[model samples]
Target: MIYSEKENVKSLIEMSLKVIRMYDWLLDLYVLDFFVDDHWEKLPKTWRDSFRDMDPQHLGEILSNKPPKQLLPLSFLALIKSVDALSIPRQNTYKPAHKIDLKNLDNCKNHPRLKNLFLKHVKLKKRHEISMMADVVVDTAMQTGCNAVIDFGSGLGHLVRVLAYRDDLYAAGIECQRQLTEEARKLDLELEYTAKKHISPEAASKLHRPLHFNITLSCYSQLVKLPLPETMMNYGLIGLHPCGDLGPLLLKHFVESEHVKFICVVGCCYMKLSCEGKQQGYPMSDYVNRLDSKLSFPSREIACHAIEVYCERLMKGNYKDLKIHAYRAALERILVEHDPKLRHAPVRSIKHSDSMTFENYCSLALERIKLPLPTSPSVWSRGYHDLQQWRRVVVVYTLRLALAPLVETVVLLDRMLYVMEKGMSCEIRPVFDPKLSPRNHIIIARR
Candidate 1:
């Protein structure tokens, strides 16, 4: 049976606290550094045994060549087992509170107009996911008696356009980027012209005028200073994928704004969260903040986006350039050794073709960081050899991968707890298919 909203939030808080206690060990890569002796002792006996008994040749073969099945090194298997032991069983089991009834909606006359606009928007924006998500938002807004919507960080205004085209609803988009707002405005006009040409003028007139969908250019921080159009007051607030601190900011706005009555937000980019000083995104709830140990930056970074996709690919044995992690780790070690003073310096990511070799990767990384290339080719060969010898690094990396979802859960739950603490009704649901959109979790709240 599905847990009550209160029970769910309480359990989430408990799980988040547990993860915070183990945060340090999960993000420290050096603990598994083969160069450091006796470090394996830090891990459980089962984990150490898995690595000790693992065949280096077999590991190398799996990394270098694709296997027929989903073959994983023993160490990776053991790491998954260890992570699973600490996982919160209820985290992934929650279903959406409301499901989309596409069949019934298809029978409505307005469905054709909605579908046409959605198809046209998809063609212009090349994002099919937004169209699918808009379907749910529109349905929910209608059921809840929302007459207007204000989309935060609306990007290209795809959702805003869809909402405005619906009969009796007014929509507005607030975007931080100037270029995107301008592009969205242009697209709005084009969509308006197309609709006028296809439908009867009276029918098109029934639809809200496309230009009524305001695309404003302003940062989220400046939202209060800007005047909300009369049509936008008392509206539903929605964001497709508000990134990092923006997600929490949306929650804060929802609670403080007397005009907002509904909220639906899908958040991403957890690593970009501001976790320092009074503005930290995590531990927003008073209960989590009062804990003895506070959340750490390394832990927050591990919870960043794309981690779910990585875990899925690893489990499915889709070994397409899995060695990039080892290559990056090796490059980091080289940077540390070359200039000990720069040991803590952040390494900026450098993109390279999939076929790029370790030596090339190191060279590219070094160049990107403005560090001088090694005087001799021997240095490059030495680093590659060291990586090959310490093949267990990949296993350790995979182990760290397992902690991602747990870390993300803490971040998401902290947001939910913040809303629940205010006595607002809220629910976390898998609004989108995980396979289609990795960042599928949506936080819905209303008073």
Candidate 2:
């Protein structure tokens, strides 16, 4: 019985690497290459035929397992099961923040901001993340003997504000963006000013004022120079969805610093991580580095998307935005014909709107890419082919998304194992609902 969560995570990591090695070829295919490179034909004929004419609703059902068929091949179904089994559950590991009572009533005072948002400033997703994340941060801090939390990439100090309210805990925010750091300070003050009115003078006086630092961790010198705020001898590093390499940087600090005794951070934008540079983010563990399977930029990009949320959209049969992929692919093919060098050219995102047409999308995209747009209706009518095959685009894309969780699992496991390699205990806790926030796995570690 693998009763230990840590052991279970490790077991999953080992298994994911084996599975990924087998499927790395498929994972390497970029969806953008669909129309430009005859990507539809590139897919295994059996796989293509299975989903060729499937309804969007049916495809959704098959993806989310509403019900399945001989519509999908047995081997493909087994592969899907293999990927699903590797993914960590996205249900919150700790109890809901509202239901959890603080252990020390004397020191852990409930902040008004925790329950009552200040003027609904935070979005629904943001509120759920900070409140739940803070609870886990506190719980882990208490367990690991960390008295202070230093949040990296702490935009707006939302997490810091919640943590600062706990009299027993000390919290500070480090943000690279100067504007956001200043705004966080202003908001922190506003929350403090309002919080003072609701509590006793004694309780108000006990409120810990969190320090905000405007520091970018671009170099090790800055990291080493990080001063301990107000004689806090021990502290934990934390982040609520630190983008790209920031989360890994925090983990790096946690492993290297004696002062950083604990960490609870969730990472996003896996595609931005450095794989070849000195501060490489992927292959953090020797185990992953030695694996025959490797994560490509396209795979990392795919891994970053919210599969669960998308699966829900599929289940609901919301295929309205589905045409965008086929349109973009058609445009890509057109661009390549116009200029072979235009292959995979950067095109600014054109927002989906009821008023927007395929031609309108192409015109805007062409304008941004500084390419000529077709003036003749005949050209457009003959140029883009088989737009009716949009469902096939979704099918292939959905198939790609099916493997996203396994990619995410592999990336997270590499981080966890990296920390463990340095004599620290580590685990990936699904602290947020994936539907609400996709990058929900919080990588936690302690020395």
Candidate 3:
């Protein structure tokens, strides 16, 4: 199944061109500050403190030699015909029809199952979508008559719970974090108790554990283990989000192994990957099947351009007065539900921490904007607190609205195409609820 060098290069070039387009779009937006919010100044006293010395302007900036917007979500090309579906947010709702809760299928989260984690300030929807999409892949594999599933980057075992809870599917999850795995194991014990006792209303407990989803845990990589594949011979396939470099590793394994019958992979965080023996940036040229000629280095301001392109789309309507909560709501909508909207700028204060002293992150943010600071600390603090929370909403909302129309669409499309060339089939669809997280779209691909 090794593709000829020319074919590989061609595919690489196509994917590279796609990323470049997204980069160009983002670069434009950055220059316009269309992506920045009134509270952007709060970044300095809060999150920006850690990277202050490293040139804040350089963070998330596009590179002169790097490819453009290489890390797009998966909602674009795979579900283009249903593009309008992207306009709705998927965060606030997780209809039970979309999921089967181990306890009671009737009371599932109307949004994606993992939405609550965002409230706890965990890894946003970006990571959550990866798990849900992987579930679809696993479901497809099971429907196709496969029995087992191997989940890479199992994290807290969210994806594993979704796949293994069913009696018909046998699943195993591998995670590198021991603490998270331990937590997941403890959670598993709680689930077993729930399933055994919660058969009736009389069994409900105030101190109940989440219903158990059966899945084994391990610490193997595609490079180090054939057991995952060997065990799947008569069963199912290996499904993974395979963030960054792990993607290529999965591909290499899929091609090299005979036991694996299917692979549904959704790759992200490309700038964090290495290729052809290099690190920190992707090398599309190394994996594509063919190309007319080696492509040149992408533009340096492409990320800004992509951001601008996105802003233009997001600001199509009356988006002049977006607040922090609204902004967050919008982002939650886009990431979870793929809803598209032109959100206004949010005016509020920003809060940094729950434990430490209150510094009115948003007051500083207003100061950065050169606005007069309110005299009363309580009023200023309350205003700023509400504003800061809303500022995050605005920031992510602006991000999604600006990027949704084309940039996010194009970049994710390229990823789907890349999967196709590697001999895998894919389906890219929107998840519900955007404000819940910015990284929406469930990308399910199979080999």
Candidate 4:
């Protein structure tokens, strides 16, 4: 359904900005300097005092928006409530879960076409995304009398293959990676061959292979030509996690193109948005621009994390797994102490971080940088005692994590508001489960 919730979306935009603006000091801090800069000591004493020794299990529950198992300050409780209020609510509106069987796609034996090639090659997370995205695109196409869909930044063309399954519609993909484009074509042919055995030769002949464009969206737009078939005079746009500027550019494409009827786009890589340049992704609408609610790079990066999954880990008593934050922070302190210039330097990935000691982590981390290994155990022993600092890290992280959805709310609302300002109908819905795919919401707009 096309959304007429401009007022509601605008109100959410305003509230999210208000809440985020109030916590400016917290969200803007670089996580790499959490210990080196003494970030924990900077937390409000009341918050620091309450969470200093809280059990991991309870903290998890609280972060998950459940009622705290024990009593806490009204201020603390109020902060948590604000996060719940400002953020976007989990949505099942787009996916007809009751009507369809997305509860388990792997176990599903419904689709005889393409055999397991359509679903088995991908993980459960991807299956959920593709299923919901395909449903939305197909539904929108049917709704708007559109017979085609242009997949913006369509990686691997999983959705393209699914759309090609229907003889009634045509599917095309715009991808930059040559390998993915080739692979998608291979998969499409495999799909057709496998599907022909299930249907008559006449039916198979009616079906078309998905068209693949092995060019970057930017490169394609620069050329300014869309040589679409006459049958595809009307089409919709579908993007499953078009990173950074690509998402906004697709919206711009929809607005400018006369043949485009509707759009279903999910975006990721928020930190890559050029907020200040001529090619800006954020502040798309005058509504958000007027609010002056600019997001920091750190906040936008945090917005990409799986908050539901993080909370789930916390609730399951997987405290050791979550210690990566404090561990990195402590490591940051050691690095900065060695060389202040080494602050925020990139380190190679350390495997099995949960089981490794801080000293072990330091050895692995420092070897890449060629920094002298700390000769003093007592000097570096600071990280050992401050292992309790994981709670502090979690506490601060929870506050920032609380603001994450609100951050996302503002970004998505900015896009929606931009579409609305163009005098088009726009809607936002959570299509994938947050635990499985946190960046699940898609912005749907119709002309």
TM-scores of all predicted structures:
0.79, 0.91, 0.48, 0.92
lDDT of 2: 0.76
The C-alpha stretches of model 1 lying farther than 4 A from their native spots are 1-8, 30-42, 52-116, 119-128, 166-168, 210-226, 276-278, 344-357, 376-378, 389-391
- State the TM-score for model 1: 0.79
Best by TM-score: 4
Clashes of 1: 0
Question: What are the lDDT figures for the candidates, one per model?
Answer: 0.62, 0.76, 0.41, 0.78
Across 173-288, the per-residue lDDT of candidate 1 in tens digits comes to 87777788888888877877766665676665666643323334223445555566676657777888777777777788788776777788987877677776666666677766
Q: Quantify how close model 1 is to the true structure by its C-alpha RMSD in Å.
A: 5.5
Q: Which numbered prediction scores highest in lDDT against the true structure?
A: 4
lDDT of 2 by residue, 1-447 (tens): 111355565677778877777767667776666767676786778888887877767766776756675567876888888887777766665663334445533333554334474334788899888878888888788788778888888888888877887534788888889999999888878877777666667876887878888987775457567676664668888888787877788888888888888989898999998887678888787766776546888889998888877877887878768778877777777778778998889986776665777788888987777877877776577545546667777878888788888989888888887887787777777878888888988887888
- Give RMSD to native, each candidate: 5.5, 3.0, 14.6, 3.5
Question: What TM-score does candidate 3 reach?
Answer: 0.48
Error in Å for residue 148 of model 3: 0.8
